[model samples]
Target chain A: MLKFTEDHEWVRVEGEIGTVGISDYAQEQLGDVVFVELPDIGKTIAKGDEAAVVESVKAASEVYAPVEGEVTQVNEALNDNPGLINSDAQGDGWFLKIKVTDASQLEALMDEAAYKAYVEGLG
Target chain B: MSQDHDVQDLKRTPLHGLHLSLGGKMVPFAGYDMPVQYPSGILKEHLHTRDAAGLFDVSHMGQAALVGPDVAAALETLVPGDIQALGHGRMRYTQLTNEAGGILDDLMVTKLADDRLWLVVNAACKVNDFALIEGALDGRASLERAEDRALLALQGPKAADVLSRLAPDAATLPFMTMAELDVAGTPALVSRSGYTGEDGYEISVAADDAEDLAKLLLAQDAVAPIGLGARDSLRLEAGLCLYGHDIDEATTPVEAALVWSISKRRRAEGGFPGAETIQRQLADGPQRRRVGIRPDGKAPAREGTPIMKDGQAIGTVTSGGFGPTVSGPVAMGYVETAHAAADTEIDLEVRGKALPGRTAKLPFVPQRYYRG
Candidate 1:
């Protein structure tokens, strides 16, 4: 199941492992993604902590960790092709994979239907 | 009530409604609610301006006219440009300086007549600029702030062709020259100069008639409304200095690589403010200088990014961003004199990492000004 954070990050969970990336809405607002600084593998992060940076033509934004976990891997292909975030923000553009520290944290996030309504409220 | 007051406090230009109608994304800039980009986005807006004509509403800029028999002479005391020698219909780029040789503001002075001169200054510095000019020239000349006038720029390679349709005489005016003409039945002061490096004209019209004139210009097939986002990127690619960012009260013209604007006569006579320090820097190099920076990779080194030489911090980027025309990242910053030379290798600290870059000659894209 995929859960979204208020900060616009999304995580898809399978067993104890979760894949993290920014939402399509976030990528659309950021314009063309020129570069991304991914967190190092094996680094532990707490929920809501700044874990990555995404730079566009005009500005840069920080992406936060939605749930506490230890990073296991990062998308190495982003170094050469950051535009993937604009093209496929949720799937191939996954920023990192981590082992969830607490499964109960997922319940606190918004599901797809709720996330859509939340984004509409912002508009 | 305070929130309502805040909204009312933000000034609006005459073209505000037009921008909204065109799908412009409004944002607060220099206390004005201005359009940063349109539905086309900044990238497309930037590229479009390079290839075709772009109409920009610069009504927020401060415009004024100095009228007096000795207006030019009086103006010279505040700025470093050769205003007295400026021929009628010619414009000169200059800066207001302080006692310490630092720039107060960069502005354009146009000689409209022997006893009258026109001025255009940055939006953010206008209030202070007007007060300084008025205070300095009080007894010698009268400064009339043109708050009732609105300024617009038609820029890009196709600007002349599109504008000439209305004011046939505008095409003959050489670069840096101005003329009083009629556009769409409204009287205007048209100058063949602009912030963009492309051939263009800045037209000053009555505030009440601004929207009508804009509608007429937008009717041209070659012209499109451009926002502040593209304006910034265009100026950056053209190697122009943005007053508050690339230059401020702490920087002198010589250090900003704008010594060319200081005419040979002004350099020799040295009567303007801060002449002593400026002359000294002209003879001997300044401690720091502004230069173009080209980052090696895709990541743009933004403003406040530290420039390092062999692990030692030397300077910081003042204006840095992606150049849509160059198809890569480009920036400008002040660096220690030792690292100011073209082709000098340096590292830019971005997000706690060092990115390789090299000093480059300005105007990442060659200027296309219509000199003739």
Candidate 2:
């Protein structure tokens, strides 16, 4: 199951863990990702905490954790090729995986169809 | 209502339609709707400008002329640059200083003729600058504001070949020189100068003809429309100062490392505003000095980032970002003169972490200005 936040972060729930990354619309707004700072593994983050940073050619933005969890792993490929977010924001661009401590918080987020409608409303 | 007011306040350039047609991502810049990037993105546009030619709008920048029998001498009262020595068709880059030795704005002055001088200033500073000059001149020189003219910059190595195809005389124009000529049937004041360190030309044409002229130029094989994003990166890599960031009302020419712009004759004569303070700084030394900085990592140290030297705050970065040409993070800021030398060890505090860096010499990329 995939859940989205109003801040444009998306998480894919797989069993007790979830893969997190920014949405395609968010990547489009931040043109040409230049660098990314990943959160350390074993770090416990609260919901909506700044878990990582994404730097584009123009400015930098914080990628927040959509739900509380312990960071189990961070994407190492992003260290050398941060543009993966611009190229593949959904799959290969996954920022990190966290062991969801509060899976109930995921229910507060929007689904794919709801997220699409929400983005359109932003226009 | 405020959002509506903000949109209503935005001024559009003559090339606005062209930018939209070319898929430009327009954003507010200095109260104008300007493109920050195109579909090609900033990295590609920056590299394209360095490798070939790039066309920039720049129509929002302020342009005006000063007319009087003794224009140069009269204008010299506000700036520290030597105006009396400028020959016909020559230009000088100088700053307008306040009475306290702080910079009001940086501008380019061109000696068009004995009785007339052309002025190009930053867009954001133009309104206040024109008013300041009008009040200070007090009939000594008349300010002829050109709110109707549009400016365009064609920059890079292939800029000459692309422009010469329209005006053959452009090929022989010397650096820092301006001439009134007919470009592709449109009359223009073309200067062989630009913010980018590349050999280029800045053309001042009638606002009504800007679109047609830009289209004509972009039709060339080597020319592509560049946005403010790449223009910023190009100037950053070139180590040129952006008015408000690298210099402002709080920074002086000496502190900004722009003493070279203050001519030797003016330094001795000392007739301009803030002359007393500037002269003192020139004789002694500035408290701090501006220098180029290259972080040893991929993280960029942006504006307001603290510069640390041995756990103590030494300075702050004013302008910084990823330099496409340098292939890494590049920044510039003022530091204690002791730690301002090239290759001086330093640390930049980005996101509360101290990043190792060094004070590098200016112009992270070698300047390729075509003197001939």
Candidate 3:
């Protein structure tokens, strides 16, 4: 299942492995993703903490962690192809894959339906 | 309510509503609420100008006049440009400098008449610039703030032909010239200079006439109203400096690669502030020089990104972005004199990872300023 943060990061959990990246709305807002600063593979991050940074031509933004976890893998392809976030934000654009340490942390994130409402309210 | 109040506090241009209606993403820039980009995005808006024409609302820039019996002499006290030689309706790009030869602000000054000097300065530095000019020319020149005026720029390869329709005489003015003309029945002060490296016209009119003038200009099929987002990218591609970013109070004209703005006559006369230090820097080349940077890959080395040579930090990027016209990443920075040469190898530390970079020639995309 997918969960989201008010800051626009999205998390997809499958067993204990969770994929995280910015949501489609965030990608659109960022316009073109020119650079992505990925965290090291073994870095530990807390829920709602700034884990990475994304830069477009006109502005820069911080990509926050959706939940507490240890980064097990990062999307290295983003180094040369950051635009994938704009073209396929949810799938190929996943920033990092984390080994979820606490499942209860997911309870704080908004689900797909709630996330949609949250984004709508923002507009 | 506090959040709403904060939003309202963001300064807005006269055309803010029109921008939002056209799907512009509002952003704070130089204390003004401005559009970052429209639905077409910065890249598209940038490319469109290189291919065609882009209309830009630069009304937020500071416009004012110096009126006095000997305005040129009074103005010369503040800047290094040869203001006395400026014929009527001629413009020169000049910099306001401090005692240590550092640039306070770079601006354009035009002689509209024997006793009138029209000036346009960067929005962010206007307050300080006004006070400086006012203080320097206290007795000789009277300052008239044009807070009620709006400035619009129409720039590109087709800018002249399109704008000629509104004011037929405007097409004949050469680069760096100005004239008062009528556009679509509205009187405006038109200058044949622009920030984009394209042939263009900057039209100055009353604030109330802005929307009407902008709408009329947009009615042309080739003209599109671009926002601040595209403006930065376009100027970057043109190798132009953004005051606070590319050049600041800490930088001098020689160091910023803007020595051309200091005329031969001004260099010899040496009457302006900081002339001693500026002339010395002119005689002896500056210690650090600004050079264009071409990062080898897509990862852009943005402003404040450290630049290194042989694993030793040397400088920092001043302005960096993806050049739509160049089809790659482009940046400008101050590097040590030895490393500022073209094709010299360097590395940029972006988020702690050193990306290989090279010293490249400026105007990463070739400039097409109309000489004729």
Candidate 4:
């Protein structure tokens, strides 16, 4: 199931793990992504904690962790090609994968349909 | 209610409507509702300006005329430039200094005909700047604010080619020279200089006819409407000092690495405000000096980021961001004189981590001014 956070990060869950990346809307607002600072593997973080940083030509923004977990993997490819976030923000640009410690935390996030409506509301 | 009032209080330039029509992303800049970027975004707009021509609406800046027989002599007391020696049609870049040798603002002063001096000051400091100038030169010269005028800049390599088609006489004006001419049938005071380190012109025209003149310039194939976002990046790549950012009332000209703007005659006479301190700094060097910083990594080191030397805080970044032309991040800041040398290794503290950087020469990209 795909879930979304108000901070513009989206996550896809499978059993006990979740993959995360910023939404297309977020990428568009950020303009061109020049650099991505990822969290280290095995770093435990709480929900809403800053997990990564995305730098654009003009500014930098922090990417928050949608749910509490330990970072198991990060998109190493982003170090060389940060523009992947601008090109495929939802899929190939996934920032990290975390070992989901509490699956119940996902229940509070917005589903795909609700996330779409939320984005529209912002307009 | 206060937020709404704040929004309403923002001043709009003559090209406000045109900016909206062109999809400009308007933002509050120095108390004015100005376009930060258009639909093309900052990166593309920056790249486009370097390759072609970028038309900028700079009407928010303050323009004034000092009229008196001794206007130049009176003006010299407030600034450190050789205003009295400025020939007709010649403009000089100068700074308004305080008693402590600190810069209050940077401005352009042009010698016009008939004992008249034209001044263009930064938008953010205009109010205070005018007050200082008026208060200082009240008896010797009279200051007349030209609020009814609009200022526009056509910058880039193709600026002269596009502008020459409208005003043939503008082509004859060399860099740092100004002339009165009819541009597209509208009377204007044009200067062959700009904030962007490119061959360009800054045209001062009447407010009512600004849109018409802008449209005429935009009609040229090489000209495009550029907003403040690209304007900033372009100036940064050119290593131009932004008044409030790179320099302020707390910064001295010598400390900011702008000694070149201080003429040899002015330096020797030593009559301008803070001349004593400036002369001393000129002779002995300031404790801290402005230098360019190039981070090794892709992440930009923004303003307020601490500059570290051997695990100790040495300085802080004042203006830093990605340089589109250089295809990397570039920055400028004041650092201890010991670390101000080019290629000196340093670290910029970004987001709780130290990123390796080096002190590089100014103008991350080489300047291409049209001297002729």
Candidate 5:
């Protein structure tokens, strides 16, 4: 299941793990992704906490955690080519994988259809 | 949401419709609804400008003329640059100083004639600047604000090739020189200068002719419409200071690494506002000096990030971001004179982490201005 947050984060849930990254809308608004600071594999974070930091040529933005979880792994490929987020924001650009500790928290996120409607209103 | 100003209250430039047609993403800047980027994004726009040519709409800035008897001498009273020595067709960058040795604003002064001087100042400070200039030069000279004019900057390596095609005389103009010529059938004041450290021209024209001029420039295969996003990064990489970010009312020319703009005559005579304080700093050196910074890693240390030395706070970053040409993060900030030397080890406090950094020489990328 794919979910999105009001802050423009996205999470792809599979079994008990959720792979997180910023939504395409967020990446588009950011212009370009030059640098990305990701959380450690074992870091514990709560919902809405800053899980990663993305730097564009103009400014920096914090990527928030969509739900409470412990980080299990991070995408190391982004260290060299952060532009992957602009090219493949939802796929190869995934920031980290966290083992979801509270499944009920996922229910609060917007689904793909709902996120499209939400972003539409913003424009 | 783009800024504190309401969207309905934002002013649009002459090229506002053209910007929209080119898929520009609009953002508010200094009360104007300016384009921050186009469909190409800032990274591409910045690199493209370094390699090719980029056209920018800077009409939002205040344009005016100081005319009548002894205008140059009159202007010298408010600024530190040597206005009397500035030859015809030449331009000089100087600051509008306050009484306390701080910069009220920085602007370009172009000598059109002995009695006429053209000026370009920051958009946000125009109202205050006009009032200050008129009040100081009262009866000595006349301040004529040009509200119907538009300014466009054409910049990059290929800028000459694109601009010379429009105005043949522009091809021979050297850096810091201006000419009253015709560009695309419109009368313009063309100067071989710009904010980006590239060979370029700044054309001042009638507001009604702006869109046509922009379209003509953009029609060139090498020229693209660049927005504020790339302008910031380009200027940052060139080691130039943005007014509000890197310079302000509290920062003086000496501490901002802009002492070169102060002429030898002005430095000795000490006639302008805050001259006593400026002379003192020139002799004894300033408390803090602006220096370029390079983070050891990829993370960018943005504006307001504190500079650390052995866990002690020494200064703060005023301008910083990723440089598309240098392919790294670059920053400029003020640090104590003791630790301002090139290659001095420092740390940038971003968020809660102290990122390792070192003070580096300015213009992360080599400035390529064509003098001849």
Candidate 6:
């Protein structure tokens, strides 16, 4: 199941590993992600940590980690086609796959309904 | 109790709701509700203008008129430009200078009639400009605030062809010329002028007719409503200066590299404010100058990035971003005049790291202005 962090990154967990990217709402705000500077593979990150830098034409933003884990893979294709994140943020735009260091971190994420409500409240 | 009521408070244009519906990330800009970009994104929007056409809602800019028995003389006293020499139906770009030779604001001035001068100024600086102009005129001329006016710019390569259908005469108005016309049956003032380096036109109409004008323009196959995001990139690509970021009161026209706006007559006569100081700078050359900077790598150096020479901080980046046309990072900054020459090696302090950069000629992307 997909879960969302307050920072707007989305994660889909399976066993002790998960794929992470930004929510559609976050991608829409960033406006045409031109470049994505990814975290190196095998790098460790804590929950809510700034994982990568995403630059748009007008401004730059930091994409944060949803849960503590070791980066196993990064979407290298994003270097050439960052617009993939703007077009299909939740699926193909996944930034990286992580090997969860602690499974309990997933429990802190919000479910779909909670995230939907949270985003609505933002408006 | 409505969140939108807050948006309405800060001057909403006709397309405010449309921007929200398009999922435009709304932000406050120049005391107005504006869309920085839509879902297709800023980069795409930026590239779209370079590739096709981008419609810009620039209604936030202040539109006023200096009307008097001797409007040209009154305007001349405030700005250094030779207002009298500007032929009727033509516009000139110039700066309002302070006594210290500092730029109060850079603006566009047009001779609409024998006794009227049309003025467009920075939205944020309009109030101050009005007061300053009024004070400078000292009742010699009257400043008429055209608050009921709306301004829109259709910019890009296809702009002229797209706008020609509205007023066939617009197609012939040569750059810097303005004329009254009926666009889509609504009376408007169309000018062959724009901030984008691309060939484009700016239309001024009654505020009440803005929605109809915008819809009619958008209905054309070549038009797309651009937001503030593309505006910044387009202007940057043109090597145009943004008021607060690139040119400010602290910087003179010479330092900002806008000495070209000073007319030969004004340069010789020296009757305008800051005449002595500006003349001195014009003759001796400025100590620091604005120049284009191209980073050696893909990392973009943005505003406030410290410029370095020999590993020491020398100046700062004014505006920087990814140039879609160049397919690389480009920037503009102020460096010591010695280092301002093209091909000079420099460094930009980006993200706490010194990135290799080179001084280069401006308009990193060649400007495609249609002078003919």
| B96-208 per-residue lDDT for model 1 (tens digits) | 99988889899999999999999999989999999998988888899899999999999999999998899898888899999999886899999999988999999999999
Q: On residues A22-78, what C-alpha lDDT tens digit does candidate 2 reach at each position?
A: 999999898888899999899998999999999997788999999999999999999
In the predicted model 4, the residue pairs found to clash are none
Provide the lowest-lDDT 10-residue window in model 4 chain A. Answer: A27-36
Tell me how candidate 4 scores on lDDT.
0.91
RMSD of every prediction: 2.5, 1.6, 2.6, 2.1, 1.1, 2.7
Clashing pairs in 5: none
TM-score of each: 0.94, 0.98, 0.93, 0.96, 0.99, 0.93
Q: Which stretches of candidate 3 lie over 4 Å from their true place?
A: A37-52, A68-81, A96-102, A120-123, B1-5
Which scores greater on TM-score, model 1 or model 6?
1
Per candidate, chain B TM-score?
0.98, 0.98, 0.97, 0.97, 0.98, 0.96
Order the candidates by DockQ, highest first: 5, 2, 4, 3, 6, 1
Q: What is the CA-based DockQ of model 2?
A: 0.54
Question: After TM-score superposition, what is the CA distance of residue B97 in candidate 3 from its true location, in Å?
Answer: 0.7
- lDDT of candidate 5 over A7-105, digit per residue (tens): 999999999999999988888888899999999889999999999999888888899999989999999999999999999999999999999999999
Tens-digit lDDT string for candidate 6 (B65-162) = 99898999788887888899989999999999988788889999999998999999999899999999988887688899999988989988988888
lDDT-best of 3 and 4:
4
- Which digits, one per residue and each the tens of the lDDT, describe model 3 over residues A29-116? 8897777888988999988787889988866788889899999999999987888999899889999999999999999889989989
Which candidate number has the best DockQ?
5
lDDT per residue for candidate 6 within A1-123, as digits (tens), equals 689988889999988888999989887766667778889999999988888888877677888889899999999989888889988999889899999888887888899999999989988
